[model samples]
Target: MDVIYANSELICSTNASINKCSRYKGQKTLKKEVTVHKWIKVSLIVLSVCLVFAFGGVCTLAILLSHATPLAFFNSDFSVPVSDQDQNATDYKAQFDALRHQHEETLRKLNRLNYSTGCALCAVHWIHSGGKCYYFSKFKMNWTQSRDHCVCLGGHLVIINSKAEQDFVNSNVKVTHWIGLNDLETEGHWVWVNKQPVNDSVEFWIKRENGIREPDNWTKGHPDGEDCAGLGHPGGETDFWSDAFCSLEKRFVCEAPAAV
Candidate 1:
């Protein structure tokens, strides 16, 4: 009976040993599974971080590209209060508006002062030296004849002094009345009948031909060595003149100071 008991004890001890080995093997397997789960979790977290960083980088790049190129469709309407931008836009707009208003006012004043517009005027018998008339006659004679006639009238042909005055006279002349201008006295050195040097800079001349006296100085080819300059209505055209002889018959444009 003791021997039977010893065999049973041996069998039980063997079974317990086998159970312990199985438990050890199961524990090892569980440890491997936990390690694998931890590895997967770490990899997932790293991937998520990378994706967030990549998304943020792409968004930043997109914004920078939009700023550097014309791809941005949004126009800052400036209706919003400026926080980071230059704040002078409003001030610049105000200054521009003020300048525009001032320009308009100046133009109004000029229009009131000069009711006339032309490059030259005829029959300007009045220069208001405070207010008085300086009388003289301008014959639409050839350059030479015009000079002689103006001299006879006790004054030389008018010399265009200013753009405004020139335009005024030219507009009112109604004919290309002879003025105190001719290259005949000297080539290219045009002088008024009063012998005042012609200021080509102030008034420009149109040239049809080349190689004369400073074609830049000639107003549509004046004083082409013609002895006469006649201003009269020719063939129902606005009166303009060609070089002619003084013997031709035509009306005269007289000028004098405005009668007080």
Candidate 2:
């Protein structure tokens, strides 16, 4: 009878061990799959950007055609939201990356704003100041998604080039918002969405309390450190630019040339 009891206990322990091993293997497989998926997305972003320079902005996104049937099934509705599709949607990703790369090249060569064409009226839900039209979105999105959304809406993220512009944007700020500034290409070298490097002469960063520094790389919020910029709310020394995680979802400000 004692031998029988010992044999039963051994069988139970073996089954438990098998279950644990199976679960561990399953978790590892899931993690591996997620890593591969992330790499694929990153590859797509690079491919889209390179394709823009190669094709000179003439070619359209190929993935858009893949969902032709589904796209055509729904009628266009512009009022719902600026970014109705998922952030991974290729239409805006392709356009945004292509537009960004093109702007980077053109802004460097021409040293000009590509979309700031003529003096124009601000559209509904947008503010007019300094001869530029700025839009404050109610929805929130990550830095990359917000950047792409601005391009989708015929503009880019707000580029506060001067104190006047900064003050104007600051006064109207209802909450923290994403700006066009980022150090994605190179750490510590901040640049605007227009590809213009930050002019060190002017400064408006979050107040240095206790001398901690504004961009203290808080939390490694971004994969390459705190690579994105966020505009703080209206407060003494608080209404300024601060580095934020690129993955953090925040409201964004969009800037464009006034329509004639």
Candidate 3:
């Protein structure tokens, strides 16, 4: 009976050993599987990171290429050539200069026309001839008073400087008119209202064939004392200027520069 019991105890010990060995093997296999699973997850994470970086790099390169100019890439100096642009700028400048010249020429022509046609610049009822404005007075006044009136009207007494001007005055004046020619400051030294001495270069005094000349200082009471000159009908010619007393009242003509 003792032998049998000893044998049974040994059998139980062997079975327990076998069970412990099986449990150790099962735990090692589970640990190895868990380690392999962890390594696989880490490898997948690294590969995903690599793919994300590669996609980002590709997107950045595309954006840079989209914004870059084609000419900048083609030229070695990286500067745009200015041949066409310079030619266009030169053409524009030439066109502007031509327009400016045309404008200046048009202004010059307008000024010339204004000078040629005096009536274009004169006021109503004012006659324009030889680049001068003339106004014929309707009332009568003395020489000094007439000059003062003309000055008040922004002009002076009519100063006859040429035969054309004299003819114009003769055709316009309906009655005797006081002129600007006078020797009031000095006898026989005639000067215009503008203080210019009367010279033969611009003189328009009428000369008669009968040995008589105009501005003869021909008045009844005063001979040489007749200082003021006037244009009137005196016997033979109707467009002759004669000196008369300064106090005598007569119609007058005023002259001024033509308005531009």
Name the best candidate (by lDDT).
Answer: 3
Candidate with more favorable, higher TM-score: 2 or 3: 2
Q: If scored against the real structure, what TM-score would every candidate get?
A: 0.34, 0.53, 0.50
Range of the 10 consecutive residues with the lowest summed lDDT in candidate 1: 127-136
Candidate 2 local lDDT, 16-111, one digit each (tens): 999999999999999999999999999999999998787864444445544455455355544233355654486777986888787556434432
For each candidate, the alpha-carbon lDDT, in order, equals 0.52, 0.78, 0.81
Residue range 1-260, candidate 1, lDDT tens digits: 99999999999999999999999999999999999999999999999999999999999998886575332323444433343233687778788788767655754554445445412222345343222223334343445565566545444566656665555555555544555555565555655555677575765343334544223332334444344333333433322334433344444443433222
The residue ranges of model 1 lying beyond 4 angstroms of the native Cα positions read 1-140, 207-260
Query: Clashes per prediction?
Result: 22, 1, 0
Of the pair 1 and 3, which is ahead by TM-score?
3
Among all candidates shown, the one with the greatest TM-score:
2
Tell me the lDDT of candidate 1.
0.52
